[model samples]
Structure formats: C-alpha cells, structure tokens
Target chain A: MLIEMLIDLTLACGVVLLSCLSLSAQRVFTAIVLYVSLGLLTTMIWARLNAWDVAIAEAAIGAGLTGALLLVAWRRLCDETAAQPEA
Target chain B: MFTKLEFRKREANRRELPPFAVYALGFVVIVLSVALMFSVVVSGKAAPKLAGLAAEKLEASGVENPVTAVLLNFRSYDTLLEIAVLLIVAIAVLPARSSNAAGVAHFCSADKQDVLNPVLAALLRWLVPLAILVGGYLLWTGAYSPGGAFQAGAVIAGAGVALSLAGRHEFLWHTTAARIVINLGLFVFIAVALSNALLTGTTLQYPVDYAGMLILVVEIAATVSIAAILLLLFTELKAMVDAPREGRQ
Candidate 1:
C-alpha cells in the first residue's frame, strides 16, 4: 500500500515537473521533448491507476505518435525556414 | 505636489500583480487542485459491477472474452459508429493530397539521410515485420483475451509510421487500393448487419450459431481499416509538413 502510494506520488511529481518544464523551456524542440516526457509520465499515471486500456492509448497515441509528429513537423519547419532567404 | 506626481507615476509603472504575487496565486491554485484530486481519490466510490451482467449475457453475445463480448457483441453499434467517427476526423485533418501526388517525394528521401539511412533501414527491416506479428497476435487473442481490434490496429499504425520515418513510406492510405482498405471495416459491418437484419428481424442481431464467426470477420476488417485510417492520418500530416504548397489533388 505504502509503496504504491509512493510510486503514484513520484509519478505525479514527475508529471508536474515535466509539464511545467515543457511550458517554460526556451527552445521549441526542448519544449516538445519535455511535452513527450510529460505524456510518458501521464501514461505511467494511467497505468498506476489500473486503467490498462487508457494507459495503452496514452502511451501509443499520446507520447509515441504525438512526439514523432511534433519532431517531424519541427524539422520540416526548420528546413522550410532554412530554404527561404533571410529578408 | 511634485513628490505626489512622482509617486503616482511610479504606481502607474508597477504591475497590477507583481511576479511574486502571481507565483503565489498559481501555487495556491495548484495546491487546491492537488487537494481536490486527493480527496476524490480517497473517497472515490468503486464503479458498480457490470461484469456479472456481462457474464450472464456472454454466452448469447458469442464471445468468451468479456471485454470483447461487451464491445463487439453487446455494444457493437458503438464500435461501428466509433470507426465512422474516426474516418470523419481523418478526413477533416487530412491535407489536400492527391491519390498519386504524395508518393513522389518519399522516393528519394531515404537517400538524402546520409547517416540515419542505413540504421533506420536496418531497424525497419526487422521492426516492421515484428509489429505486424504483434498486431495480428493481439487481434487473434481478442476472442478470449484482453487484446482487441483497436489495439491491434494501433500497433500496425505504429509500424507504418516507423516505415515512413525510414523513408520507405507507402502512403498506403492515399492509394486507390488503400482507401478501400480504410473503408473495409465500415463496409463489412454494414453488410453483416444488414444481412443479419434481413435474415432476422432486428439489426445487428446475428444468428446464434454464426455470431462468433461474423464478429471475428468484422473484427478483422475493423482492425485493418482502423490501422489504415490511422496511418493515413499520420501520413497526411507528414505530407503537409514536407510538401506544403505542392500537389493539391
């Protein structure tokens, strides 16, 4: 009982830290990485809560897919900017 | 009078709430929310048991797994509409890529990535097949286990994304054959449901002996279509990021 609570508490703290860091990070790329971390922490939270169904969805779609999409979009956007001549 | 005017100007320059005050207010809100969450967690009433009800009807529903019975038999209509809703969302978020246009750019993308190319290719060489295997296993296990069509489909979509990242992108959902795959679930569902209705009097009411086989068939189609639709959604966004201004068809 105590161990479970401790784990949940740690997950909650990690989630909070990552989420705040995601918002406060200077670079968009760094912020996105933090957001992915936050999603992962949230996935852990869902698993801790014993909602396996939700946990899976959160892990796959939330962290995995979202993180990949964000990184790809960021890279593409950077490429577009690089291709354009500076005004 | 000069001292008073100077004090007023200083007051005007000051923020309505100082940074310290803002932080304190945010801290308070966070604490309150945390307390609320704790209270809810501590006092949360356990959800009433539906397993018994599900168990009682499981035999008639024609599935051994209670969850599968609940989703595919007892509440199959919801699953049907859920897939339709997914298709609609995919359509809405999808960029204006033609059936043939999105395929041209990825042809050379693998060659451009000098260092990552070999690694990604080597990894996907094994990973994609493994993903397919896992997805199929999950689907097949749904009859008496926890895995199901949606889970299987998501796994397959993950594999497709990996393949895309490796620059072996198929844009499978963009091709004519792919659209049919995307709609296969919905088409099969309607056909099964209508046939059931015609045979029986009620919609989605499968025959007692045939319910299990029919549900499995629908599940397979749903799994394939769902994966295709999700991959399409993933690839459509990718297409937007890569080829924004070109190939609108």
Candidate 2:
C-alpha cells in the first residue's frame, strides 16, 4: 500500500510539474518538449488506471503522432520568414 | 543612502504576480475541480456494468475478444459512424490546390540522394514492412486480443508518415493511385454495409459464421486507407514547406 502510494505520488507530482513547466516556459520549443513529456506521463497514468486501451491510444496517437505533427509544424513555422526560430 | 548595487538588487528582488483577483479565480477552479474529483471517487458502485452483459452475449458477436466484439459487432454502428466522420473530416479540411504539389512526386533527383538518403532508405526499407507486419498481426489478433483496426491503422499510418516526411519525390504521394487508396476504407466499409443489407436482410449485420473474417477484411482495408490518407496529408504539408525553396530558386 505504501509503495503504491509512493508511485502514485511520484507520478502525480511529475505530471503536475511537467504541465506547469510546459505552460510557463518562455521558449516555445521548451514548452512543446514539456508537453510531450506530459503526454507520456498521462499515458503512464492511464496504464496505472488499468485502462490499457486508453493507454495505448494515448501513447501512440497523443504522444507519438501528435508530437511529431507538432514538431513538424514548428519546423515549418521556423522556415517561414516571419516566425522567429526560438532556441 | 543605499548603494546603487543595493538599489538594483532590491529592484531585482521585486517580482510581479497576477493580481489577487487571478488568485481568487484560481481558488474557484481548484475548489470546483476537487469537488468534481470527490464526486467521481464517491459515486463508485458495486453493480456490474455492460461488461457482464457483453461477455454473456459474446458468442453471438462472433469474436473471441470482448473489446473487439463490442467495437465491431455489438456496437458496430458507433464504429461505422466514427469512420464516416473521420472520412468527412479528411475531405472537409483538405489542402487548397493540393495537386499544385504534384510536381514533388518527381523531385527525387540523383543529386539529391545525400548521405541521409541511403541511411534513411536502409532504415525505411527495413521498418515499413515491419510496421505492416505488426499492423497485420494486430488486425488478426483483434479476434482474441486488445489489438484492433484503429490501433493497426495508426501503426500502418505511422510508417506511411515517416516515409512521407523523408521528402523523397519518388513516392506516388499525390497521384490518382494515392487518392484511390485513401478512399479504399470507405469503399470497403460501405460495400460490407450494402452487401450485408442486401444479402442478410439487415443493415450492418454479418452472417454468424463469417463475422470474424468479414471484420478482419474491413480492418485490413481501413488500415490501408488510413495509411494512404495520413500520407496524403503529410505530403501536402511537405509541399507547402518545399514551396518557398522552389520559388527562391
């Protein structure tokens, strides 16, 4: 029971901290990276909740595919003359 | 009098936060969220849900996997509508002048094959088939496992997407073949619906003995279509990205 509680606490704190960092980060890329981590953490939470189907979908589509799409879009935006290529 | 350095340090120490009103708003949000969470945790019931009902009725659904039976048999209408919605959304948000990028299909010049091409090509040559294999297994196993058409489709689409991003103009990405492939899922799904209605005398109802095989067939077609559709979208985006470079030259 104590171990389960510790695991849950660690995951919960990680999620909350990652989310807050993603939201408050000044650099857009940093936020995007943080968001990907947050998605992954949520996937872990889904597994912990015993929703295997939700966990699979979240990991594959939410984190993997969506993060790739977001990064691709970000790269495209950077290529555009107007957008600043933030580090 | 305070030194100039002390004055600068004092100014640096002062950090601005959102007003008290914002914290008040945060307090409200926190309270509401906590209350909602409490209700969800407290409202747990010991009664069985539809899992028992579905399990009891599973044999009739013609699939060993309860999840698959629920998705492709008992609640097929939901899946049908979901795929239909996906198709419509794909069409509705299609890129303008999509064919303008058709020239990209032939952009694979010998000079362009850099150090990355051989490496990427080697990897893709190895991986795309693996992806297809995995997707096929997932579709086949849907009759007995957690894998299903949607998951399989996503896996296949992931391979197609990786290839599409490689920026190789050799692939028939924006061609008529691509369009047809993209529509294959809708065509097969509708064919099943129509055939079942005409032959079985009911809509979306499969013959008991052939239900598993028929669903598998639909899943395979959906996987192909999904892969093609995702590739099409990615190709369009790549074209947009490539446009400026072409214009500059």
Candidate 3:
C-alpha cells in the first residue's frame, strides 16, 4: 500500500511539474516535447488506476499521434515563416 | 499631471502583470481548484454510480467487455454521433483533388520525392505491416478485451503517419474507393440503427441472439473509417506544407 501511494504521488507531482514547465517554456518545440511527456505520465496513471482501455487510447492517440501531429505542424509553421520573411 | 500621464502610458505598454499580481492570481487559481477537487471527492459518495447498472445489463448489451457493451450497444447513439463528427472533420480537411483525364479526383500534381533514407525505409518495411496486423488484432479482440475500434484505428493511423514522415509511397485519399471507406463506419452504424428500430421498434437495441455479430461488423467498419480519416488528416496537412513551397518556387 505504501509503495502504491508513493508511485501515485510521484506520478501526480510529475504531471504537475511537466504541465507547468511545458506551458512556461519559451520554445514551441520544447513545449510540445514536454506535453508529450505529460501525456505519457497520464497514460501510466490511467494504467495504475486499472483503466487499461483508457491507458491504450492515451498512449496511442493522446501522446503518440498528438506528438507527431504537433511536430509536423511546428515544422510546417517554421517552413512558412522561413518562406515569407516579411509576413 | 504630465508625470501621471507618462506613468499611465508606461503601464499601457507593459506586457506582463506585476509579480505580486501574478502571484496573487496563481494563488487564487490554486485555491479554487483545490476547493473544486474537494467538492468532487466529497460529492462522489452521494452520486449514484452507473457501474452497477451497466454491469447488470452487460450481458444483454451483446459484448463480453463492459466498455464495449456500453459504447457500441447501450449508448450507441453517442458513438454514432461521434462518428458523424469525425466524418465532418474528415470532409473539412480533405485535400482538393485535381482531376486527370480519367475524371477521377486525383492527388494534386505535387512533386514526388523518394525518402532516400535507407534506415527509415527499412524500418517502415517492417513496421507498417506489423501495425496493420496489430490494428486487426485489436479490432478482433475488443469484444472480450480492452482494445477497440478507436485504439486500432489510431495505431493504423500511426503507421500512415510513419510512412508520411519517411516520405515513401504516396497515399491516395481522393479516390472514390477511399471516400467510401472513410464514410463506411457512420454509414453502417446509421443503417444498423435504422434496421434495429424497424425490427425491435427501438433504435440501437440489438437482438440478444446476434448482438455480438452486429457489434463486430460495426467495429470493423468503424476501424476502417477512423483509420482512413486520421490518415487523411495527416496527409492533407502534409500536402499543405508542400503546396506553399511549390508555389514559392
């Protein structure tokens, strides 16, 4: 019971820290990376709560696909800025 | 009066709040959130739980997994509407296709470039097929397990995303066949709902004898449609990324 409590505490703290860091990060790429890590932490929390289905969805969609999509979008934005310096 | 006006001008230009104000706002937010969480925790005891009710009728819902039973049977209208929303998003993001001589909407005449990265190519060669297999397994096992159409579809879309990132084979999303596949889930779901309404005089009420089979069929179609829609979102956005570059050149 103590061990489980410790695990839960760690996860909760990690989620709070990552979310704050991600929101405050100056760089968009860094923020996206941190957000993905936050997603992973929540996925683990879901698993610990015995919601296996939610864990899978969070890992696959929330973290993996969302991270990839954000990176691609960031890249696209960067390309646009590079192409149109005045805009 | 002149000094006061200057100070007001400076305040207008300031982009951030004073440190004390920031701290105060943060403190207020924290306190409110904690109070909200406390209320929810205390209220949960008084709230009537649906888990018991869902469990009682799980057998009639036609699936071994309670989650599946609820999502695909008991409250299937929500799922149907969710799929409709997905279809709308898919339609919104679908790339504009330029027609060729065949009169079929084809990929916009964007330049094709092979990925050239041998490692990525080799990785994809193994991973894509494996993803498809896993997606199929998830769909098949959902009736009795934690996996389902959404997870399976997301996995399959991940495979497509991987292929897109590698810049390998071009995915054709504009074809008539692809459109049908993308709409198949919502179409099949609505059809089933109407048929059930006709037979049982109530929509989404599955017959006990064939509930499993009907759920499986719906899941299969949903898996295909979800995968296609997600892949289309990625590919179309990716194409937009390329489109602007081509115009500039």
Candidate 4:
C-alpha cells in the first residue's frame, strides 16, 4: 500500500512539474515536446485509475494526434519566410 | 509598421506583471483551490448515485460493456450531437478544390520531394497493416470490452498518418465517393434515430430485441466516418505546410 501510494504521488507531482515546465519552456519546440510527454503521463494516470477506455483514447488522440498536429503547425509557422524580415 | 517580433515584445512589456502582483495572483489561486476542495468534501449526497441504477439497467442496454451501453444506447443523443460537431470541424478544414483540377488529389502526386527514406518505407509497410487489424479488432471488441469506435477510429487514422509520412499513399478526399464515406456515419446515425422513432415511437430508443444489432450497425458506420474525418484533418493540415511555399515561389 505504501509503494502504491508513493507511485501515485510521484505521478501526480510529475504531471504538475511537466505542465509548468512545458508552459514556460524557452523554445516552442521544447514546449511542444514537453506537452506530448504530459499527455503520455496523463494517459498513465488514467490507466492507474482503471479507466482503460479513457487511457486508450488519451494515448491515441490526446498525445499522438495532438502532438503530431502541433509539430507540423510549428514547422509551418517557423518556415524561412516567417523567420526572415521583409526586404 | 512594426515587425511581429517587435510588436510582440512591446505587448509583452506592456502586459508584464510586477512581482507582488504575481504573488497576489498565485495566492488567489491557492485560496480558491482550497475553498473548492472544502466544498467538495462538505457536500452531502441528496440523491442516490447513478452507478447502481445504471448497473441495474445494464442488461437492457444492448451491449455488455457499460461504457458502450451508456454512450450508444443510454445517452445516444449526446453521441449523435458529438458526431455532428466532428462533421462540422471536418468540413471546415476541408480544402477548397483548385480551379485546374476537380480536387486536391493532384497536390499529393508522388514527386521527388515526396519520396520516403528506405527504412521508414519498410517500417510503414509492416505497421500500416498491423494498425488496420488492431483498429478492426477494437471496433469489434467494443461490444464486450473497453475498445470502441473512437479508439478504433484514432488507431486507423494513425495508420493514415504513417502513410502520409511515408509519402507513397494517395488520399483522394476531393472525390464525391470519399465525401460520401466521410459523411456516412452521421447520415446513418440520424437515419437510425428517425427510423427508431417511427418504429418504436421514441427517437434513438432501440427496441430491446434489436438493440444490440442497431448499436452494432451504428458503431460500424461511426468508426468508418470517424477514421475518414481524422485522416482528412491530418492530410489537409500537412498540405497547408506545402501551400505557402508554392504560392511564394
């Protein structure tokens, strides 16, 4: 019981820490990567709660698709023209 | 005219909070959180919890899985509206067809720039089939297990994403047939609801004898549409990446 409580405590703290770090990360790319890790951690939390259905959906949609979309959007926004000033 | 960076920097400086103000805000958050937790702990249940009630009715809910029963049979109206919202999003993101061609299919024509690396190509060859198989299994297992249309659809869409990354597969979302497939889930769901109303005098209330069959049919159609819509969202967003480059050149 103590070990289980410790594991749950660690997960909850990890989630809070990762979320703060992701929000305040200097680089957008690092923030997006951290955000994906946050999603995966939430998925684990959902599983630990015995919500298998929610866990699967979170892993697939929340973490996987959202992360992929964010990465692509970041790529598009940070393209050469966007980085360079007009002549 | 200010550059975006300069404008953003100015805005940031204007909006910057003093250290004391930041601490004040943090204090407010902590106090509110404590108050909320206190309310939750003090709350008494005036009404009996619904979990017991739901369990009692589970036998009549068509599916063995309570989650499936709730989603598809018990509160199907919410599910219906959710699908409609998804359809609206899918339509909003769909690219308008180019004038030269009837559809956006030509945009993804396998040019040299679209080629995949050999290792990724080999991985996709194995993974895509496995994903499809898993997706189908999830769909089928939803009736009795934790899997369902949303999970199955997401997995299938993941396969489509892998194919898009591989750069060899062509998505023909621009075609009439593809559009039909995309809308089929919502169309079928509404039809089922209306037909149930006609037959049973209540919309979306499946007759006990036919409940399982109706739910299964609706789930199958939903899985297909959900998968198609998700794949379309990914491909259209990816095409946006190439679109600005083309216009500039």
Between 2 and 4, whose TM-score is larger?
4
- Between candidates 2 and 4, name the one with more favorable DockQ: 4
> How do the residues A54-77 of candidate 3 rate in per-residue lDDT, one tens digit apiece?
999999899988898788777776
The deviation in Å at residue B184 for candidate 3 is 0.4
Predicted structure 2: lDDT: 0.73
Tens-digit per-residue lDDT, B150-243, candidate 1: 8888888899888776655546444456667878899999999999888998888888789899989999999998887787777766766656
Scored against the true structure, residue B129 in model 4 reaches a CA lDDT of: 93
How well does each candidate superpose onto the true structure, as a TM-score? 0.76, 0.81, 0.87, 0.88
Weakest ten-residue segment in model 1 chain B by summed lDDT = B1-10
Q: Every model's Cα RMSD, please?
A: 9.2, 8.6, 6.7, 3.8
Identify the superior model by DockQ, candidate 3 or candidate 4. 4
| DockQ versus reference, model 3 | 0.49
- Whole-model lDDT per candidate: 0.77, 0.73, 0.85, 0.85
Q: Candidate 1 at B108: error in angstroms?
A: 14
Tens digits of per-residue lDDT for model 3, B105-141: 4532222564357887788889999999999998889
Q: Which run of 10 residues does model 3 chain B get worst, by summed lDDT?
A: B1-10
Candidate 4 structure quality by residue, lDDT tens digits, A1-87: 999999899999999999999988877789999999999999999999999899999998999988988887777667644856655
CAPRI category for model 4: medium
Between candidates 1 and 2, which one is better according to DockQ? Answer: 1
Model 4 RMSD vs true structure:
3.8
Shift of residue A12 alpha carbon in model 3, Å: 0.5
Clashing pairs in 1: B98-B249
